[model samples]
Target chain A: MAGKAVPNATRRSERSHRAILDAALELVAEVGYPKLTIEAIAARAGVGKQTIYRWWPSKAAVLLDAFVALGERAAQEAEGPGSEAPYAFPDTGDLEADLKFVLRATVDELLSPTYDLPYRALAAEGIVNPEIAAEFVSRVMEPSVQLYVERLRAAQQAGQVAADLDPRVAVELVTGPVTARWLLRTLPLTHAYADAVVEMALRGLSPR
Target chain B: MAGKAVPNATRRSERSHRAILDAALELVAEVGYPKLTIEAIAARAGVGKQTIYRWWPSKAAVLLDAFVALGERAAQEAEGPGSEAPYAFPDTGDLEADLKFVLRATVDELLSPTYDLPYRALAAEGIVNPEIAAEFVSRVMEPSVQLYVERLRAAQQAGQVAADLDPRVAVELVTGPVTARWLLRTLPLTHAYADAVVEMALRGLSPR
Candidate 1:
């Protein structure tokens, strides 16, 4: 078996990687994170348990990869026609419109069934498991959030946002309600709600 | 067994109830929600599994009750002197001060070791379990959120907030960052953070 496994077996290894990730995501969506196991994922993926062990440290690692893949795909789909891949928020010099546009896309993603189940399971798991949660945050949540931070910083430079505003907290003001509503199920996560959040956050809650 | 179970049964039942809750909380904190079981709780509480079964439908129910009890105790301790049982947001006719006060208290609760462990466990459980999440929202999260809604409504009526603003979404502007900060561990949830959130939400994120 050791002799049969070559150092340059790139195609076979890539096939196994895809299979493992797909199996991990399906199992997590079906049985949830707690019941998901390496044995089960390997069996479902038609790979040996050793094959999975060779690449990933734990089930959380597999799930994290699956989630990142899903997010990347979603971002690509949300990008505009003839746009470059891995799209950034458009700097139209109109902060409100740009934010509203991005938030509307976010609302759609949050509401999508494909993204919702696995992501929710991962997020729930993260809440209790600090190690896994840290991975999820650093690998998945923080990178995307930094996009908003970058956008806000640009806006600040342009005098659209308050110059002294903390871009991190400012990004949260825009993103937080969308997350809170989806996570808590407090209200319908509609485009209207997203628009309202952008409006309120950008315009302030107090009367003008 | 039934006939002999009457003497001090009421007192015994109350004691067992408290014991069961404590045991459930401890087990969840130690081992997490999926590994937590009725038998373990019963054994830890010095009661029969049947006793737990007779009272609650599932481990989620036991944890939920335990969380409610914990929150109630925390509220009692946090309430001010001459306060009417700290259930609602205290409307002292100063929106900013009232909001800052409540959010600072929330920051303390989120930071405190006593509340963090079991609450995080239950919140983790609630995220994936829709039924439990609904119960949590309707019973705990919403009622607390509604206090903000009520306060915002009063602010709207007082012309402090825009008449067109939805108090529901308005409340999220105030509450969402605190929750985001706590859940994401993105920043230190200090009184200063709470104060900044209050200022940002009240004044809006727009440039003056």
Candidate 2:
């Protein structure tokens, strides 16, 4: 049914691309962002440095791609095979329950060692490196963050949230605490934590 | 500081210690964390390697001290000299106003490039290295964080915050958004942002 047959050369190149990305992810986790190098990545991937250079602009670029790929893989695993839709914050009529559902999944993802290691590396680099930080936010973080924003907007319309509230900032009430606990690790990142955050966000901390 | 001080020797050692911390901060900002080293810090500080090792355990430790020193300096500058009390969250009896004041101050600190660069480096390293992270949290972050817990507790007693909520987790509602905004740079870290976070946290985002 296809117009053209896939060439062996193209397929081999695709394999090398995936291998290079995987190698980049592993090396960053093992040695950290400071020690990771193109040569090490090349050796680990069994590819020439030139091949990598032909595609990615730098080591951080490659790692960002790898991180995205890993996140996509995680998302795919959650939804079963061939799922292409990005993560959506649930919109059950009960806003608190939906938020708790999403934030709890987020807590689980952030605490996982496999994702956590490479993410920490990338995030650390992003903090100091403005260029990478911007890209990481726009490309990787913002999309998911927007999911929360959209859900908040919907809740506001449903009269679960105040109509005048900025959905962007309101989303932060739930997400910010989740993120803080997740990043700081001062307290346990648990479903209980997510529930607390959602309840606080919805009920307000003041005596109601 | 107490009993057995040889004035000249003690003063000189203190000077050298300050110099090492200053150098550590400067180099981390300039080269980023990955390139920072003990030798470089020594050279920058005009001290020998032994001088540094005599005082701090590692480059990370030195930076942590430097960051804390910088923060203390900022706090002192804000309150004027001879202010012994660390930054206490304002207990103006208006919970929203007090939180807004502190979070606004936090926004300014995070956005200012002077503290931001070195802070970013340390935070990045802390993410990957659990040892440094724990120390950074316990030593640098926790004291200020405790201020929030105390303030929230006061609010609870005063009939401001809901008594059932965990003050520890509730604090995250204020902190998380500030941190997420600061770290991501997806939005401007500003007073307005702090105001929004405080409003959302206190009033609840839902129709109240």
Candidate 3:
């Protein structure tokens, strides 16, 4: 009986943890990040404020963890159940096709109503608040950007990309323009725009 | 006496207009765009709320005009008084040098403490609010981006850039990455970074 009670307690804790993260995402999407509070998340999750404070240092931490978890869940859904890896940027041995494919998927996600408000809220906060900016980049942005770096490195080895290029900066040639369009709303984010960006990046803007 | 009184009244109205713009800039920097109100701007500018409403339709309108006026003032200062044009993207007839020069100046302006908070406040608001986003993009962003468009077109005409490339999209290759770094804070905004972006954009990621 004593051993069974310990297992039950662990399951309950996990349930509460998941609930807190979900609640944080919901509230931020509904109210925006500036107004989000741990108290509100706790209430929405049916947990105590102390429960949140015990595990996370601030609302930003909770939101970051929630977003990370959301990404992992999204990855799992896109893949299949029991998938171990969170993501694998497609590698078709064709750099242009691979990048265009991934960027189109990114365009879809950015425009998705479910992710749009919450992501924008966090991004808006990060733009103004330095502490949130550092954490957002480290936890969310840097890791995703690393995927492009790895793919670009592979392309370089295959003689598809220039060996001299820094994969980190090279990734930005495709990403930066797409991001600028999305963030600034200068143009509609679409698959065609993504393909154009890939073409311009792979082929020099000056005559080759 | 009546004709002399007319000049005095026009001077007072000009003073009020300048004061309102200045107050809007200062308040937005201090309290951020979310908290800014016409009442507060009027109070700070030593004008009646009716006076503000008489000129501008909304707080966003006031702030937009203030930012535009600020840019005009800064451009005048940089170019000296009586400068006819607001901006001239450098065209030394060297595409790479010209782009790098302009991006470096952009980096400086983005980082300046005087403009940082106010710009961020507007950008942050623009991120989440579609109404603000459209207004901000058209009023502030479009005009500035046009400068890059004009410069790129000149480069293309001179046989420096590929004539086939769209200057609008091509400009994003340089500006997109810089704006991303500024908005996301993924890395430091620096002259060296700008130079690398210019090099990467001009020279394709693929081996020439």
Candidate 4:
């Protein structure tokens, strides 16, 4: 009877975990992070607050988990039908085309309503809370950023990128303008804008 | 008698305004923005809540004014001593050197404790509050960013930058990486990092 109950308990824990994440995401979207309380999350999830505390330490931790779950969903959607392979920059040997394709997808993600509210809230909280912000960066941002770094490294090996170029910094040059435009709302973040950034960062502004 | 009293009252109001801004800055630094309250600011400033409300609509507005005041002070200091000219990028005809010099100063400003705390609070708040964030982007970020746009436009006309490059987008490529590094704290924002960004940006990362 003890062995039989063990699997059932584990299943209950997993269901509770998903409910908490879903509740946290909905509450953050509706009320924003400052007002998002653990009690509210627990009530929304239909679990006791102790159930939440048993697994997560704080609201920030709960929100971070939600965001991670959301990102995983996005990646799966991007990968699409039967492509069990994880999402990566497609290197078709034409660097510009591959970059443009990836950037266009990024533009779509940034513009998507599903991702926008939570991402903005998470980003805002991270700015003020250094520890929470660092975790968000390490867990969510770095993994995707590493893909860019890897692509740049591949380009360098292929002699497409400059031998001296640091792949990490090079990736920033490509992605930075898009992010700045998105965050600052300085201009329209369109496919054309993405294409222009790729061209400028690749060929540079200097007339070579 | 009424005419003479008007200037005295105006002077008193101005004094109160300064005090309120000072109090707001101190309170925000000590308590963080989420914990900061208008009542607390009033108490710290030795003024009534009505006095703060008369001058600014909300706590965010008060903090915004404080930041504007700080920017003015930084600009004044940047112009002091050997800097005979007001705050403009030195057009030394070498774009790389001019960019490097300006970015190094930016690195110093972002890292300074005096500016970092309040700036982080305001930036974080702005991310969640679209209206406030838009005002900040327009009032604070744009004016400084325009300096870069102006410099790039001048460079473009002189055949230093690509003639077809949009000055606005070009400016982002230069400034975006620095801001991204600072905001995300993904890596050490150092003088070396600043220099590398300028190099990768100005001269495309692609093999020359």
Q: Specify the highest-DockQ model's number.
A: 4
Tens digit of lDDT per residue, candidate 2, span A1-208? Answer: 3444556677899999999999998898788877899999999999999999999988999999999999888788889888766685677688888888888888888888778877777777777677988988888888888888888888877888899998888877788877766666667788887888888888888898
Locate the minimum summed-lDDT window of 10 residues in model 3 chain A.
Answer: A113-122
Per-residue CA lDDT of model 3 for A1-208, tens digit only, reads: 4778888988999999999999999998788777899999999999999999999988878888888899889988989888765677999999999999989988998899767767777788888778888988887788779999999999999999999888988988889998888887888999989999999999978986
Q: Write the per-residue lDDT of candidate 2 for residues B1-208, one digit (tens) a residue.
A: 5665678778888898889888988898788877899999999988899988887888888898899988888779989888765686789899999999899888887777788877777777777677888888887778888999999999999998998989988888888888877766667888888998888888888796
Q: How high is the TM-score of chain A in each model?
A: 0.86, 0.90, 0.90, 0.91
| Chain B structural similarity as TM-score, candidate 2 | 0.90
- Mind sharing the TM-score for model 1? 0.91
Query: How large is the C-alpha RMSD of every model relative to the true structure?
Result: 3.3, 3.0, 2.9, 2.4
lDDT of 1 by residue, A29-49 (tens): 788776899999999999999
Q: Cα lDDT of model 2 overall?
A: 0.84
- For lDDT, the strongest prediction is 3
Model 1, C-alpha of A203: deviation from truth (Å): 1.1
Ordered list by DockQ, greatest first: 4, 2, 1, 3
**Candidate with more favorable, higher TM-score: 1 or 3:** 1
Model 4 agreement with the true structure over A7-107: per-residue lDDT tens digits: 99989989999999999999998898779999999999999999999999989899999988887776689787565434677889989999999999889
DockQ each: 0.71, 0.75, 0.70, 0.77
Compared with the real two-chain complex, what DockQ does model 3 have?
A: 0.70
Q: Which ten residues in a row have the lowest lDDT in candidate 4 chain B?
A: B78-87
Candidate 2, superposed: residue stretches over 4 Å from native: A1-6, A80-82, B1-6, B77-84
Clashes of each: 1, 0, 0, 0
DockQ (0 to 1) for model 2: 0.75
TM-score for each predicted model, relative to the true structure: 0.91, 0.92, 0.90, 0.94
